[model samples]
Target: MNAGKLACSLLLSLLTAQLPACSFNMNVESMLSPPRLTAEQEQIYQKLQNSVGSQQVRLKY
Candidate 1:
């Protein structure tokens, strides 16, 4: 029973240690303003917006 408990605790600790590798940090700036597009991207975006006509279109990267 004691060995089983020890093994469980070790497994839990190892999982906890690995959790940060799968975690991500949020960028407050990006959330607020988002990144700008390159010239080529801008042309494509404009084309998309134009294709949509008066309706609203949004692009996210």
Candidate 2:
């Protein structure tokens, strides 16, 4: 019984640690009006935004 409790506690701790890492807030408007990016940087930024957007959606669900 003690071992089972210990395993459950450890699992919970690991999950909570990961939760903080998943916690993210982005302000895309800050980027929108910023100085222009080089073509390569713009493409990369767009890809990042798309990826983050998807992640945000998943988190909301």
User: How much is the lDDT of residue 26 in candidate 1?
Assistant: 88
Which lDDT values do the candidates have, in the order given? 0.88, 0.73
Candidate 2: worst-modelled 10 consecutive residues by lDDT: 52-61
lDDT tens per residue, model 2, 1-61: 9999999999999998887666455788754663667899778777877888855422111
The digit string of per-residue lDDT tens for model 1 on 1-61 reads 9999999999999999988896555888756877899999899989999998999987757
Error in Å for residue 35 of model 2:
25
Worst 10 residues of 1 by lDDT: 22-31
Q: Deviation in angstroms for 4 in model 1?
A: 53
* Error at 35, model 1, angstroms: 0.4
List candidate 2 stretches off by more than 4 Å.
22-61
